[model samples]
Target: MSVDNFCETISDQINTGILVVSLDFTIVKWNRFLQVHANVTPEKVLGKCIFDVFPELPKKWFERKLSSVIQLGTQSFCSWEQRHHLFELPHTRPITTDSHFMAQNCTFLPITSDNVITHICILIEDATDVCHYQTMLNKTLESLAMANRIDGLTQIFNRKHWEECLAKEFSRARRYNHGLALIMFDLDHFKLLNDTYGHLGGDKVLVETSKTIQSLLRLCDQFGRYGGEEFAIVLPETDLVGAADVAERIRAAIEGTDINFQDQIIRTSVSVGVSIINSQDKRYEDLIQNADNALYKAKSSGRNRVCLSTELP
Candidate 1:
């Protein structure tokens, strides 16, 4: 077979679309793949301006790319990620969802004769399956990460994740010498509620209390289930007074909220302790310990009250 026949055979047999355009953007060579996918014949498109044939094409963008290849003697590439499709080809994959056009990655190569650039060849590769797989993988990874960080019952940050956030916030506050606060709170007489209403009723109280406290806190504040019925909160850039105010608000909210369980309304209250980071604090745990101690004092003095570590003698 002749060289021309070999070239024609390769162009027709390849899966990718190939189109050759002159410097004036006139279609010079339209391969079979392009003819079938674009629903245009070579006889009709040859010697015609490509933009006129496909008016939806990004003319200015393609012109710049073509000019670069012609002037700089280099190639250009466009991925499916950057641009979905160069041509509105029919979707052939029936199993894929939310896809209408064939995703494509395109390449532009300069076609030179005797070192004088004459035409540019555009090659298009189908990338639908690859793009779909990548999107699905990303969503799966995101769901997995969320599951690991969130508490199963409370729908809030778990103890381990909350501790990680506290450590980071503590370091940031200490490094910048900014104010930070910790609040530890738990239900008063939680065992009594559990015995009276069973574990399911106790769970209802925990869930409702978590939601109430979360609604009262700021977006920057971190609230998490430390363990069992106990919870902890991290307040960045907040001083002792601000932290105490937050604790009081949460305590009031919980006391006011009535959790419904099995046709009965159960009321509960929380004891809160607030502690601010001080110059003498060595680690994040030191702040937690102070808050815990203050919480103990609140429970001893009276339930449903907020206490500050600084106020303790």
Candidate 2:
């Protein structure tokens, strides 16, 4: 066997697609992989312009890539990450994967003859599996990050996430003097209620109460589980009076809800404290402290009621 015949045998056996094009984009060579995958024989595509063979291909962008390789006499690359495929070829396993077209990572190789670039060898590799795995990995990471920001039982923002939101809202209020309010509330006599019902029942109560509160909240508002039997709400574009109104609604809503757990009915109430950002408030912690003091007052003066720091002595 001769050297040229030996090279042709190797190219045909390889799984990758190989096609050589001249400066005018005329197809000079097409390997076996390209023939099978593209469903075009060498007799049909050879000596024809690549654009005429693959009309759907990105013409202007591909010209730029080809021109650069020819001028520089260096190899260039086209990743699946940037553009999905160079040729409009069907995937090998379209039934299994989401990709309709074959995911391809292509390389533009400068075929040099005596330092003058004569042809451009385009190598196409199937990247469907790699693309699928990468997509799944990204989604998993997003789910994990989202889980960290949420409370497990209630599915609302956790304490840490809630605080982060508050800090951002507080900064906005300070900068633009936007109306912002914070409400902190805890279930009234939660320990006694837990004693009457099991821990499972308590979980039910928290979940139900959170759902009820969420229904009344705006999309911009942030609600989160503060701790055991406790929850907090940050109301954007709301003032002291507006927050008090919201707090009252929350109190009445909870007082009305009758949670059923294991065929048993459970009634619950909450003591809510509301506070709005004031000029004297230097940090978000100050808003938290004021709301906490008002919450204490609500508990002391009989639970299931709303109190406001602005209204306190």
Candidate 3:
């Protein structure tokens, strides 16, 4: 076979699309792959301006890219991630269900005849499969990360994740010398409710209570499930009085909200403990312990009220 026949055979057999254009953007060579994918014949496109063939093409951007390759004698690459496709080819791949057009990764090579650039060749590869797989993988990773941070029952931040948030908030408050407060609350007589209403009913109560409390908190406040039937709230830039007000509001909201379970209206109450950050406090654990102590007082004094750590005798 002659060298021309060999070159023609290679171009026709290759899966990638190849299109060569001169310095004037006129088509010099149009390979079989380009003919098949672009639905145009070499006879029709040859010697014609590329922009005229594909009027929707980004002419300025394409010109800039071609000029760089011709002037600098360097290749240029375009990934599917940045631009989905240069030419709007039909998405015929069965694997790419979500894609509307063929995703492409294109490379521009400067073709030098005798140490002088004469034409630029564009090589385009179908990247639909790779792009689809990467999108799916990213979504799966995001779902897993969200699941890890969320409590299974209440749909709130899990204890482990909430503790990490508390530590970071503590460090920020200490560094800036800003006011911060912690609130710890638990359902009053949650064990008795579980025994009376069963585990499923108890779950409904917890979910409803969490939603109610969360609705009353500010956007800056972080609320999370501390444990079974217990929750914690971190109030940034809040003093004892502000934290107490928030705790009282949450306590009232929980006490008033009724959870409907098994065709029965179940009423529940919460006892909240409020503690402001102090100079004596060393770590986030200290704030939590103080709030826990106040919560104990609230439970001892009554069942549905808020108590402050400083009030403890």
Candidate 4:
């Protein structure tokens, strides 16, 4: 075979798309890969202007590479991920882990004739798998972050998440002067219950109590297990009266429910203390402390009761 025949055969066999264009950005040659992948037939696309074939190709994109190759006689790469929309395709090439990639990685090399640049050859290779894998990895990481924010035992917002939310709600309340109430409640004699019931019965009470309180809360309220037997509620746009009412409702719900364990009906009750934000209060710490004081007062006075700190003058 002659050298010309071998060169032609090599060009036809290569899987990568090849396109040769002149200084004026007119197509001079289109290879077999280009014909198949780009849905362009050589008979129609050859010797045609780029803008005429694909008018959507921005002027800046063509001007940057075409002018540079003609003037500087330099070779440069054009990744399809960056210049994908230049063509008039309705959908971008879909990338998957198991499928053959359809993206393009092109190199622009100056073609010289008689010591003057006449044309440029653009070589393209597919790189779709890399993009798909990166997208999947990012989604997986986001799912993990969301899972870590939940408490394992109580299935509620963990302490870290609750503190962050508290800080954000505090700032919002301060900014808008909106009513923000914090209620701190704990299971009275929880330690004794855990000790008497061998931790299993105590676990049952905690879980059941959470469900009961959840049913009574409004959509805008946030409830989280602050610690072993203590839980906190954040009520947005609720005044002291509203907070006190909600607390009483939760107390009543828990007091009315009975936990059955091994054919024994065990009564469970919660002591709740509620406090609404006062313009006079200086910090979040004070709000929490006031609620905590009320909770202690409830425990001291009697279990199964709701007390509001804002009632104090």
List of clashing residue pairs for candidate 4: none
TM-score of model 3 (CA atoms): 0.92
Clashes of each: 0, 0, 0, 0
- Which parts of model 1 are misplaced by more than 4 Å? 1-3
Candidate number of the best TM-score:
3
How large is the C-alpha RMSD of every model relative to the true structure? 2.3, 2.4, 2.3, 5.9
For the record, the alpha-carbon RMSD of candidate 4 to the native fold, in angstroms, is 5.9
Where model 2 places Cα greater than 4 Å from the true spot, the runs are 71-74, 114-116
**Residue-wise C-alpha lDDT for candidate 3, range 1-313, written one tens digit per residue:** 9999998999998989898999999998888888888889999999999999888789999999999999899999999999999988866676555877889999999999999999999998989888888888989999999999999888888999899988999999999999899999999999999999999989999999988888888898888999898899999999888888889888888888878998999999999999989999998999999999999999999779999998532
Query: Candidate 1 — what's its lDDT?
Result: 0.91
Scanning candidate 1 in windows of ten residues, the lowest lDDT window is 89-98
Residue 47 local lDDT, model 3: 98
Looking at model 3, residue 64 earns an lDDT score of: 99
Model 4 whole-model lDDT (C-alpha atoms): 0.80
For residue 312, model 3's alpha carbon misses the true position, in angstroms, by 13
Q: Which of the numbered candidates is closest to the native, going by highest lDDT?
A: 2
Clashing pairs for predicted structure model 1, backbone only: none
Q: Residues 32-60, candidate 4, lDDT per residue (tens digit)? A: 87777677799899989877876766778
**Worst lDDT 10-window in candidate 2:** 304-313
Candidate 4: 10-residue stretch with minimal lDDT: 84-93
Clashes counted in candidate 4 amount to: 0
* lDDT of model number 3: 0.91
